[model samples]
Target chain A: MQPKRLSVLGVGLLGGSLGLAVKSVASDCRVIGYGHRRATLDAALALGAIDEGYDDPAAAVRDADLVVLCTPVSLLGEMLDRIAPFLADRAVVTDVGSTKASIVRLSEERHPGIRFVGSHPMAGSEKRGVQFAQSDLFRNAVCITTPTDATDREALEAVEGFWRGLGMRLKRCSPAEHDRLICDVSHLPHAIAAALVTMQEDAALDLVGKGFLDATRIAGGDGGLWRDIFLDNRQNLAAAIGRLRTSLDDLERLLTPESSEALRDWLDRAAERRQAALKP
Target chain B: MQPKRLSVLGVGLLGGSLGLAVKSVASDCRVIGYGHRRATLDAALALGAIDEGYDDPAAAVRDADLVVLCTPVSLLGEMLDRIAPFLADRAVVTDVGSTKASIVRLSEERHPGIRFVGSHPMAGSEKRGVQFAQSDLFRNAVCITTPTDATDREALEAVEGFWRGLGMRLKRCSPAEHDRLICDVSHLPHAIAAALVTMQEDAALDLVGKGFLDATRIAGGDGGLWRDIFLDNRQNLAAAIGRLRTSLDDLERLLTPESSEALRDWLDRAAERRQAALKP
Candidate 1:
C-alpha cells in the first residue's frame, strides 16, 4: 500500500535520501521534509528529494500516513515528543537511528499513544548533508526492523513494507539484538577507527599509506553524529571493545614468542574469513 | 650514474614493480628477476617488468652492479647470504621489506662485505603477485631509506638516486626509527584489521556496512607477508598496540560518564586530523 503522505524529520543524508527514494519508487506518495535549517530543507526540495519543506515537524506529520525520524540518536525522544500530539491515529512511525535499543525504549516511554516501529537501514557514506543524498542510497541495503512484543503488528508491517519498496532487504530482530549485532558490525568499527587515528603522531601523517587511510576512513565522519551513537549505545560498544581488546591481546601473544606457525594460521583464518564476508 | 644491470630477488609485486619502474625511467638498465617459481619470473618478463629471469640467485647477481632483495622479511637474511658470494665488489644491495631494523641488523651481520642499504616503499595493495605489478606503483609514493653509521655512503647515494628516478619522494632515518614509525602507520593498522575481522561472528557478516569493509580491508591481504612484518617488528608493533589500547581506554572512559563535551572534543579532533592528513 502506498503511503498517502510520508514525512521525514532532519532531512540530511539519510532523510533526504529516503525522500528521494520514496519519490522514485512510489509515485503516489507525497514526501514532506522537516528540518531545523531552512537552507537544508530548501536544498532537499530543490533537488526533488521532497515535494514540500517544513520548518515545523508537527505540521509536517499532521496528515502523514508514515513518518520516519532521521535525526541523531540523542534527539530521538525529543523529536518524537514534539510530533506525538500531531501524529494521526493511523500513522505508523519509524526511525533510521543507528542504535535501536535506546531509541525504541525512548519512543515507547515518551510517545506511548503513537505506534512507533524501529528501523535501521545499513546504508550511509562518509559524506553528509542533503547535497550528498541520492535516490538509490537504500538499494540492496540491509534494513533492520526491531520490533518487540509490545510493537503494533500493523505498524511493523507498514514500516518494513515501506523500506522494501525502496529495494531494501529486511532483517527482523529485537531492538536489543539489533544493538548487540550492530555494536560489532557498525559501532565497534567507528570506535576503532577513531582510536586508531588518535594514536598517530602529527609528524608521521605524511608517512602513512593506503592501509592506514582505509583502516581509519570512518574517523573522518561527522563528530556530533558519531558522538551521539557512541554515547547512546555505550554498553554494547564497550563490550565490543572488550572483545577487540582480547583479540588484539591474542595477536600480541602470538607475536611475542615468535610463534610463526600459529601466527600464520591466525592470519590465514582472518584473511579467509574477511574474503568470504566482504565478497560483493 | 645508471647501472647497466639491476637484479631483483623473489620478483613479485614489489620486485616486479621495481623492475618495471627502473626499465621505464632508465632505458639502458637491464632488469634480471630471480624467483623460486619459474611461472612468476616468466610472467614478470612477459609483462616487461624484467628483461631476463634467473632461477639461481647466484647467477642473477653475478654480473649485476645493483641487487635488490624483494623477498619476505623472514627470508631477507637467507636471500642475502645466497647472493653474497656472487655479488660484484662495487654492487649496492637493498630491499623493499616492510620492517627495517631486523632486516638491517641481519644484513649487517651476514653480509658485511656487501654494501647493503634498507629501503621500504610505502606503496602496495591488498592485491599481490607479479600479475598485479604496475610500473607506476612507486610514482609519488613515499620510500623511506634506513641508513646506519656503518652504511656505505656510496651505496646510500645510489639507492636514494634509484628510488628518486622511479619518482619516489624519499625520507632518511635510522633502521630503529624506521621500524618505530612504520609500526604506528603500517604494521599496527594490519594487526588492528586482522583483530577486527577475528572478532566478528560468521552470522553477523551479512549486516556489515562499508565502514566495516573499509576498516578491515587489509585483513584480506596475503597472510604470509603480513605475518612476517608483524613478527619481524614485534617490539615496535607492541608499543603501537599499547598506544592504541590507551586511546581506546580513553574513549571508553569518556563514554562511561556520558561526557558529551569530552567525547565530542575527541571525535572532532580525530575527524579534523584525518580530514587534513587525507587531503591529496
Candidate 2:
C-alpha cells in the first residue's frame, strides 16, 4: 500500500510542506513537484522538499501513485481539465483545497479517468511560500478528508493513510460539512479580522500594541485566495457572516452614544463563553 | 527618594507580578501585600511575590513609601478610599488600571493627601492567579503613565524612571487619551475576539484548530474584569465599537451574494493587504 511516487502539483507552502512531512515518516516515498512558476519548482527542490521537479505536470503525474492539486482555489477545475488525459487509471488525485464541495464536484465530473479525494490539512503559518515549508508543520493537526458519492473508498483510505503517516490525525467528513465547519471557524474569522482592522477609526496607529497585532494578524493574510474560498463556499460563509453581523448589531444596539450598560453584559457573556471553550 | 517599604494592595496576578518584578530590581524595597481574601494574600507570600501578608488595609499601607493598587478595575477606587488615610505623605501611590480617566479623576479628587499616578502596563497572559505570577513579565513591553494636572513632576519622573529601569518603553498621555487609544486597539479587539468566539455557529468546537484557537485566544480571558473595563470606559468603547460596525457593514456590501465577481475583488483586496502586512 506504499506510494511509489507522489506528485505535488503546486509547489507552494502547502505542497512543499506536505512533501516534506511525507518524507519525514516514510523514507521510501519519492516526491516529484510541478508548479506554474519554474522558480517555485526549483525552490522546492533546493529546499529538499521534493526529490525532483518537473515543468510538465503531465510528465509529473505520468507514474505517480498519488497526485495532489495544490494550486489556488480558482485554478482547480482548469488544472483538473488539463491533467485529465495525463492521469493514469486508479492513480488517485487529491487536493489541499480549503473548500471541498466544489473541488470534489469539479474533479468527479471533469476527470472521469482519475480518482479524486478532497483533503485539507488545517495547518500552516501566516507565510505562504515554498521556503516556509516544514516537516513538522502538520504535527498534531487535523487533516480532513472529504469523499463524495463518486469517491473511491480505496482512494479515500490511501489519502487518509498517507495523512496519518505524516503524523496528522485523519477526520472523515462529507465535502459540504467540511466547507460548513471550516467556514464557521476558519474562513469567516479571517474575513472578520480584516473587516475589523479596516473598521478601526484610529488613523494614528502609533498606539497599537499586541492585542491589535493578534486580532488583526489574520486580516493580513492572502485575500485573493481567501476570496476564492469564500465564494466557493458562499452558502456557508454567508450564513456565518450573517451570524457575526447580527452579533455586531446587537453589540451596537447595546453601545449607543449616551448609554452602554448592556454592552458590558454582552462582553461578559462573550468573554465567558470564549474562555470556557479554551479550558480543555 | 529610595522607597524603604512597598505595599501591594492586591495579591492577585498583577499585584504578585509587580511585587516580584520590583523586588528583583530593588533589593531594599520591603514588599508587603494584602487582599480581601486570606488565601490570596497567603498564596502571594508563599510564591515569594511578597515578603509578608496583612489583613488590614491601614496596616498594609501605614509605613510603606510606595503603595500600589492592583485589584479589579471596579475595586481600585474603593481600595484607595480605604487606604488613603494610612499613606505616608510623600509616599507615591499608583494603580494598574486598564481604563485611566476615571482612575485619574478618582486619584485627583479622593487621594489628595497622598501622591497618586495612573499607570498601565501593556502586557498580560490568559493565565490568571497568584500562581501564574512571574517576574520579568513586563520586560520589553510598553508601560503607559497617565498624569493629571495635579501630578507632581518628581513623582511622575520617579514612576517613569522605575518603569524604564524594568525595560519598558514609557509613554506619557492624558487619562482620556490613554483610554481612547486602548479602546481603539487593545480593549476593542479583546471584546471582538470574545464576541466572535461566542457568536461562532460552529458548535461542538472540540474540532477547532490553530487558526480558531489563535484567533479567539483572547476571548477566553477574564469576563468579569472585561465587563468592568467596558463599563468603566463606556464612551470610548462605544466609539470604537461604532467604527468596527461601519467597517463590517462595508464588508457586507462588498460581499453581496448576488455579485460573485465583486465579492472576489473585495476578498482580493483584503488578501493583498493581509499578505503585505504579514512580512514581519
Candidate 3:
C-alpha cells in the first residue's frame, strides 16, 4: 500500500530525512512538509527533502494517506490535536518521537478515528535541522515501532513496511518496553555525558584528549531536544541514573588495596561486554 | 643536544612510541627498549620501535644520555631504583608516567644526583602494547612537563627541548598541579565510563547506538593499567569522583518541570564549552 500523499510535520533532521528517503525510493509519492517557521519549510524544499511545503498543520494533512509527525515529544500531543479534524478518513498516521509510551497514549486519546503508530528511528547526529538531512540517514539504521494490542494490524504492517522500504531494519515492541529500553541505552547516556562535562574542572580543559572528546561529544547535543527527552521519560531515566550512581559508589568503595582484584574484575567485565557488542 | 643513545623502559605503547618517534627524527640516535617480557621487547625491535632490546633495566640504561621510563605508575619507583646504579654520570632521566607527583618525589628521594624530570604526554588510545605504537603518536600532542624547584635546570630544558623536537606542544606545570588536573580530566572520566557500562542492564544492550558507544568507549581500556592509576592518585581521583557525584545529583534533582530551566542552562553551558574546544 504505497502512500499517494505522505505529509511530514516539523521537517527537521528526522522528518526531512524521511521525506528525502521517500522521494528517492517512491517517485510517485508526493512528500509534503509542514514546519512552524516558513524558512525551515523553504529550506527543506530547497534541499529536495520534500516535494512541497505547508505552513498550516491542518492544511498539510488534508489529502494525505500517511502523516508523520516528526516534532519533539513535548509538541506531539498538541500537533495531533491540531491535525485531528483535518486528517483524511482512514489516514494512517505515525510519529518519530523519542519516547513511545506517552506519544502512543496521546495519539489514542486525542485522535480517536485516525490510525496512529509510534516509531523511533535510532539514527541521527548531534547536529539538528533540515540542512543535515540526507536520503541515506535511515540506511542500515534500526527503526523500532511501538505497536500495542489495540493498534490496527493493517496500520502496523503499513508502518513497518514503510520503514523497511526506506532501508531501515524494523523491530516491533510494546510502547512501554520501548520507553524502558531507550531510557537505559539513550536517555541515561545523554544525561551522563552532560553531567560529566558540567563536573569537569575549568583548569583541566586544556589537557583533555580524544578520550574526553569522544566521551562528552553527546553533551554537545541541542539542550531543548534533550531536555524534552529527559522530561518525557523522567521516571525510567531517573531509575537508570540511580543504577549508574550505585555502580560508581561500588567502584569508589573498591578503591582499596584489598579490593584491587575486585576492581580489576569489574573493569575486565566491562571491557569484555563492550568488545562483545562490537561483534556481529 | 640530540641524545646519542636513548633508553626506554617498559617498551609498551608510550616507550615503544617514544623510541619510534626518536628513530624517525634522529637517524644517528640508537634507541634501546627494555621490557618485562622478552616477546614485547622483540616485537618492539622488529616493529622498528626500538633498535635494540634489553631484559635488565640496569643494562638498558647503561651508556644512555636519555632514559624514558614508560612503565605503569606502580613500577616507576622500582625501575628508577634498579637503573640508578647503572645510569651514566650525566644521564638525563625522565618518565612517561600518568601521575607526576609520586614519580617526581620518588626520583628526588630514591635516586639523588640522578637528573630525573616527570612528563605526562597527553596522547594515547584505549589500545595498548608495542604493536599499536607509531612514530607520529606524539605529533602535535601536548607533553606536560612537571618540573619542580629541585629539578636540574639543564635537565628540565633538555627534557622540554626533546619533547618539542618530537613535535609535542610543551606545557610546564608543578607535579602536584598535574596530578590534580589529570584527576579531573582523565581518571574521573575513565571511572564514569566504566561505571556506566558496569551499571548497564543486559537486556537493554541490544538497543544501544553511537551515543552510548562514544560515552563508554574509554571503559574498554586496559584494566591493570587503569587500576594502578586509580590507586596511585586515589585522593585527587576521589575528589574528582565526588565532584561528578554532585553534578549528577544536581541534574537528577532538576528532572522536575519546575527545574527545566535549570537543566537547560546546565546542558547549554556544557554544549558551549565542548563546542569551544573543537576550535583550534
| Winning candidate number (lDDT) | 1
Q: Give the per-residue lDDT digits (tens) of candidate 1, residues A132-156.
A: 9999999988899999888999889
Rank candidates by lDDT, best first.
Answer: 1, 3, 2
lDDT per residue (tens digit) for residues A120-190 in model 3: 98888888999999899988777899998778989999998999898888888899999988898788888
Docking class of 2: acceptable
- In model 3, the runs with Cα more than 4 Å from the true position are A1-4, A24-29
- CA lDDT of B48 in candidate 3? 92
lDDT tens digits, residues B1-280, model 2?
A: 4467988888878888888888888887899898888999889888889998998888999888778788889898888899987778778888788889988898788767668889998777766789989898778778889988899888888878777776778888999889988887777777677667767653426456777777777776676677778778877877887777777666666664466677666656655554443332
Per-residue lDDT over B214-273 for candidate 1, one digit per residue giving the tens place of the 0 to 100 score: 998988889988888888889898889999999998999999545888999999999888
What's the number of clashes in each of the models? 0, 5, 0
In candidate 1, the residue pairs with backbone N, CA or C atoms under 3 Å apart (3 or more residues apart, or in different chains) clash, namely none
Q: Which ten residues in a row have the lowest lDDT in candidate 3 chain B?
A: B271-280
Residue B187's C-alpha lDDT in candidate 1? 87
TM-score of candidate 3 on Cα atoms, chains taken together: 0.94
Listed for each candidate, the true contacts retained, as a fraction, are 0.83, 0.51, 0.74
**DockQ, model 3, C-alpha based:** 0.74
**In candidate 1 chain A, what residue range of length 10 has the lowest lDDT sum?**
A252-261
Per-candidate TM-score against the hidden true structure: 0.94, 0.92, 0.94
